[model samples]
Target: MAGRGDHTTVPGQFPAQGLRAVLGGWSGAGTKPRNDDAISGRIPETAYEMQVKGAIACIADGISTGLNSDKAAQISVVQFARDYYSAPESWPVRDCAGRLLNSLNSWLHAQNRSGSPDAEGMVTTFTAAIARSTTLHIVHIGDTRCQRLRAGRLVPLTEDHSARFMGGSESLTRALGAEADIRVDYAQETMAEGDLYILTTDGVHDTLGEAGMRDRLAGLPQESREDLEAASRALCQAALEAGSSDNVSCMLLKILALPSETLPEAHRRLTAQVIPPAMKPGNRIDGWEVLEVMHSSTRSNVYLVRRAGEDGRFVLKAPSQNFAENLQYLEGFTLEQWVGRRITNSQVMKIRPHEDSRFLYYIADFVEGETLRDWMKAHPKPSIAEIIPVLASLISAVRVFHRLGMVHRDLKPENVIIAEDGTAKIIDFGSVQVSGFRDLERGDKEELPEGSLNYIAPEVLTGQGAQPLSDLFSVAAITWEMLAGRVPFDLEERTALPSRPADWAAGDFAALRPDLPPATGEVLSRALAFSPKDRPEVMSEFLGEMRKLQGRAGTRPVFVPLLQRGSRGFWRGWALAATAVAAALAVALVALLP
Candidate 1:
């Protein structure tokens, strides 16, 4: 039978009647608590929608080995619940889990691409439960355990994704935010009146085995709130005593019935707003005072700003008025908002605080340095040894995005700014596209074109396709320019820009920059190849190959701009035509006299 706490509702309180749940989870690093991750939020009330019969309960544990495992687990649970609650009620419980996972995948891909410093490749194990009447539906991944405690017996509801369970794959074979495809285990069962459901991370289960768990949980008196709390504490203490050095957390949910005074209050809570408000230029929102407009594009407006009640300043970005007015533009804006708000990566910009606003706004630590374009213009391209770290960091950021199943369609010298400390930041997400996730539930072929014309992947230019490798090609092009100090493609006035797949496929960078190292040039060649399949399929491998050329380094070569004096033949002839024109006019007049 299903436990009573297996109901689904939005996060926070409910409007009517249902179950009560408490959550606890813990993480261990063997000798020290590296990451203790767990979360439990009850919809304080209950409701009866067509597809949903009871409330929803969720528990998540991030695989602690990845960076910021604790944070990953916490955000996954909180954000998933938050999104499920706000979602339209058309989907069944399983469908809801699928959609939520899709959204999480997209966000994780973006976060990975951004190369979140704290948790770039972080993965988590979690289980989410939604109850309809007496039925409980669960979606789970990783080793985090989920079980029902009823009639003084413990019943396991989810399986572990550990190495032992997967034929000695020492690492987690499945986890949230770890890959593009998450393997979720789902099941359903009926609930009992006095049932209790518990979810916990490995730290709690590793120390308190099945028998140990039953002993503590069964002894608790259900009638007394204090006894329940004490029993939960005793279980945690027992894990610590058993030499579990991880952060331990657990959740306990009790299933009961409708209370007369609770229903009305629960109903009112459902309509409350959770998103923050939009901030405009020159307006102070969340203590970041907007100062001067930095730049504006079709998508967002960047501003030079100062922090409130602080000495430091930062850069703020908000979606343009045009973008905010259109629902399509909201995708880019909301993505930035979601990525900026949830990630705690130093490499990523921080989300600006807001109140009940929906548009995107974020504050980036202002880099006091020039862009790669400006730097290359002022000084010769630095040696590969000097360039590796910068390139590596940038590559890592892109990897972060790729892991989340996203492609940043644009990457150029102008988009990468190098701070005084030599840290490279790749910005501008206007052209990013999700591979398997779409807000409108539309087909991939139907999505509109989104990316810069110059740096666009060949397939994207032809409206043929886009993938993670496409973005890698663009990154290679930018890296080439960073070292070569000139774009690989330079078309004369007589020729049109290489806007076609044929142009990109046949064009040779070696012919343009003969001075570039042959090995480096070949790497760039394959990356910018006309077909997406010809490029590096994965970012990590591409980066690994690029690293080989970094320290081998070459001397800076003199660069002739595409528009040099010798190349401006047509303009020079036009500039010297005045005397010739007069002489021609005189001869014509003399001929007319004859």
Candidate 2:
């Protein structure tokens, strides 16, 4: 097998400045050994860049023990990086993963169908580590592991997909080429001097638990001539002693310390990295002027923009450095773009991006209206006549997503913008969950979905799987607040809001305003159901129920529950004095009285 000695470092890790990393791994020359480990690299080409750069290394363990497992693992790691770097800069993480998986699946399946037993049931497990500057992004699957050693203790930084504690039926839960697409577990950790990272095949991990591994690493002194190499040897010896039977491979990494003067320079260097020049003003990016910045967010920046070729205008969204650096955020942003494009209506904002590339900025039709929160505050207690129409519009707006088989996981008043025409436009598909977007077989839930904590559905707050019903629950909460003049959960005396499964059931929107129309009240009760299945199955059902209650009264606005005009009471003595004064005035004005 080729080693790190031959492969280059990743583009982002070059120029060898602060936090230099050295990765060296060896395969034991034991009997029945199969060199199932695959590694890749990229080093700086320019002398100046290399002077201030670091290095990146990745190790993949092909399940050589299984039929053609070695080949399967080898192809996955190699193709992943190749496909990743070759793709356009705008490729979203999910799209990238999906594309890579498709390429791999096609290759693996074709190889399997070629009538060779080795290709028939072929599968492999792998773990990969990407180190750059001062951070490590670890992506892995199966029992192959990545461990972090800080202050002489080895920490398992990567979760074992097959670990029984994490619901791996009996062993490792996931493996490469196990199915059509692979699910990679990703995590990011800061790299510091004196930190040691270890990536290994199951052979090494099976031999030592955390305590046992710590003992072996503890004996080695840092900076010793043989420290790094010896540590790998000790692990192998321990595994052998523990009765390991498979080939043991290990990639040991040591983060070399940096000089004090270099730390500040590195900070300046990283921060000074400039964005590429923007397109010329007249140059259109998806028909929107790349206007000056409006706002910046962790994932992306919002720009106040106008349509280039048309009379329309919108807010153009560009991925932030934070989103661009990480694959996950890029994927989520891509999904938002996808959902927005697929479902275009007056109720939903029109989302347009540069043709085919995920890297391009997107234009969303801007809504010129106040958020529901702002509207409600200006008119403290609005009657049903004033509120029901807004609710109807919101429900009508959200109904489009349901028809598209999508759920707006985050539906709050803040996300609902009431347009000047009274059209309550529902925006922010950023948190939407479409049925096609999920992979149920692996049970991987969407991470940190965008939503307001105050308005999230009870089921969602507890980390339950997001579904259509949860969206309904949130919609109900918003509607309830519309009619009741207050949030259902606000009056409760709790240190913090309940974050448990039971708390969702405890909320009663009806209790906040019992005087609400029976139909409106019933809809709220059903929508805020504890179990997601019990809520309205779709937006149409909720809209139908709302329309029924709205029709019982006239189309005109009414402030029935919100306010009323009262007559002023007259004082008895004041009335008598006023009468006497009126009688005297009446004598003088007799002609006027006649």
Candidate 3:
């Protein structure tokens, strides 16, 4: 008494034209009285979502021994596909899927614990495949499986979690509600245009086997969605006809195309606007009038602007025409706007949306403040007490970027703005590195480091990519300059940039400021280590050490003798003493003569 339960086909429609695939799913009960299997999937309607979160296909199989196994299977598959698309687009696909699966497992376990006694609780096996960009990300638990067929070769992508007992009996070693805590397997595979992926439950895979499934899939057309649907139904039917006594399910996804692996492709897909030419005062574009040319450089231009019929002012930034054809620079410019719009911290500048604009530029909130460079110039050789508050604010700002999976690769005095109330806001997103963007990139080409030479981390200079530790290094360099009136490394004095990590050495902070506690120098030294591994494991650790130094500054003595302080202090002290001795000798000679 075999019967089909549910069947669906998610149409292959990519309006913006990227990552196209065709999906079909079918489920049925072979001989069991009730079918406790579920299948679900989603293809986003928007191209932005496709590029960021991608499409998902999931299947779950409930244990027949459980009373509410059907409910468990349905809930797991449906909830996972729905919730995964709702996650932040900035998160890496692996992180988003891992977190959702963990949460889903916990909720299923809780339902089992709260169920009525005298009946087995809900339990099921789960497996999912996410097609993002040019790769397939797989997450799995229990015996539910995902496999790929490429170039006529069928490859298993997931391992079953069931174990055979001594007497030939089998039991699941892992499932969604089998335990309070779950450990799921994760893997990735590079996808090709003609690749076909299959997802199945043990009912289908164990009964038909890979050989039988391949036999059923042989001669299936690649482009016809109807043919893929027929193949999915055939696989389940073949499994049941082969003497399967349980629920059978099968899902098919065929990759028809992948996104282009180039910066120009990304630019075209992201925006259709043209880069605005160099702007000056009185220039108007997209209803915003440029009141002043704030700053202009070969890379970009910043202007103070005001929109028509608005009293508030804004800062508009545009990429320079010099790099109009530079795809990498244009991509970074677009990413800067994307990052700004997503972040909502007071310490980070906010991007105002202008969806109707025809030019490539972003408008940001204008904060009235002086650059940290100007502040440093005004308070040359600022005391440790004076620097602690500013440093704390700067660190707070940086933590926001880190929490959002970003690294501000360039952190220097000029990039920070200090308000009259001592609030520090980090600016300049040109060099920020985003984990999400890295996941989307296809190539692994190395490029020169992206920050001012003195402030960039030593590891980055040597071709190591920027990380949170790299940002910490830049912050420490800025802090060192504020306290000692000089950078930690004299990068300007070098004939050329350091080609190796060993060539870059941090200058001696203790030698310049002996009045501060020795621990202060130790903290800065650790932050500016030549290797990222040698630095504090996280930004919080570096901040903790800085706070400790700040706490000790009150009790610590700063009245060291001038000779031990520094060269300038020692020479000034000597000059004052010599002048006093000369005055004393003149008085003595005058009295003796009189």
Candidate 4:
């Protein structure tokens, strides 16, 4: 049997229109007694879902030796695609697919072990391609393969996990339900216009070969859905005629168009509501009454407000009317709402729904706390013990963003709120860098570094782009300030800011906090390194070191042997000794001559 279809995002649905593509698939029993091959694909209907999850296409081929191989293949393809979409949107594509595949494999493995007599067990090869924004994410296992057709050339994207014996017979070394623990191959590629992703089982590709497949695809009209479907069927048919007996399946996803701004459509959606003018307390707009102005700035205004009949207090953040015409700023302001709505964590501020509002603003849960800057002021010289808990909470919160493929580009003391109970909540999404959103953007626009000079990563200043390591740099700076009562680098004192990564240097932590252990300074120094490569790769590693530092207490100053000290200290001591010896030898020589 052969099957095919297509999916396209509804027009004019999102402020920034999302990924667009065409999907088609075909499967056949070939010369086999029964088809154990299955193919499935999904493209979300809503713009939000389309942007977050994008689309997924899967193909699975069951082992002929298994009693329920057909059922296993069907479950693998259908359930894998269904479960992928059901995963949390906040998760990165790799995380979503990896976690789902692991769980699915475990369940299938358990089912196989519990089967009755006469059941040989269930096993199948699986491969899937996920297209989100402008990236293609691939996950593969066993002999099923994923390939890309770009610029009229076929490119293999996955390697077969099979082993061949002396007589040329082959068997899968890895497959779903074949083992208790599964190792999946995952990779990603930048998607381009007119790219066609192909997924096929061994029955099709092993027979047709890459050359044959490429020639067939080259002959088809790439853009037309009908032609794409016809090509899928044709590939399976050709494979069957060329010889051998096994189930044949193929799936094709063509990139119809990459995301580009439909300006009129985007402008209409983004500017649906007028930017509200500045207002003081007692002002009313959009059902919510302003109680007090929480913050005001040239970029945005944050107001503390409450609904007419509700006792709950909320914070309403509105972009400055001055930027009403600044589409980029407006888009970022809108993205704040999008990000806040998707992230559901107590450590991160939550954006509440206000469907009836008529103004261009978003309401979030009002956190009762002082800014971390103020917290630092109250404890100018806090011990490592006092700072560890706060750092722990902050690290946990930042990891949440990292896991979601987001970098809080503007992490600073003012951006973190320390509640009365000591919990921390990260705020201000104005400068967040989201991986998915980056793909939606139309062009590269040069912009200044987002965070404060003292806290922003050195690499970001040099246009290396915001990353998880950048956030780590900011956190380390904050921690240094908490202990030393000053930023690691007095950025304000410099005549000119560092324009390159090599020019940036962190102040000596040992000089500032000599009373603490040497390891303490070493830890902070590494985290505050000018090169991100010099820092810990993950937050957990950095946090683990901090935790170790917390257990050590302030020790009385002790004299150290020159050899035991740093290279600089050891070399300086040797130079002083040599100077004394030369002076003594010169005096002795003068006395002997006289």
What are the Cα lDDT values of the candidates? 0.62, 0.63, 0.82, 0.81
Residue pairs clashing, model 4: none
Task: Determine which window of 10 residues in candidate 2 has minimal summed lDDT.
Answer: 4-13
lDDT of 2 by residue, 12-94 (tens): 22235444555555556333446565654433445332222224445666655567766776677677756554543233334
Ranking by lDDT: 3, 4, 2, 1
**Selected candidate, larger lDDT, 2 vs 4:** 4
TM, every model: 0.48, 0.45, 0.88, 0.81
Candidate 3's C-alpha lDDT? 0.82
By descending TM-score, how would the candidates be arranged? 3, 4, 1, 2
Worst 10 residues of 1 by lDDT: 1-10
Distance from true location, Cα of 105 in model 4, Å: 3.4
Q: Please, what's the RMSD in Å of model 3?
A: 6.6
For each candidate, C-alpha RMSD in Å?
16.6, 15.0, 6.6, 10.3
Specify the highest-lDDT model's number: 3
Q: Over the stretch 1-594, how does candidate 3's per-residue lDDT look in tens digits?
A: 111365556545454577887777788876888888888877777888888888788899999888888888888888888888777676677777788988988887887787565225689999999998998999999999999998778999999998988878788999998898889999998899889999998888899889888888989775655776688888888888899888888888888889876665655744577879898899899888999999999988999999877779999999888877666677777778888898998999898777677788899999889999999999987777788889889999998988877888888998899988999998787778877667686573334444578898876776667888999999999998998899878786788877765666666677787767778888998898888889999877887787777655433455777567668867888899999999999999999994
Predicted model with the maximum TM-score: 3
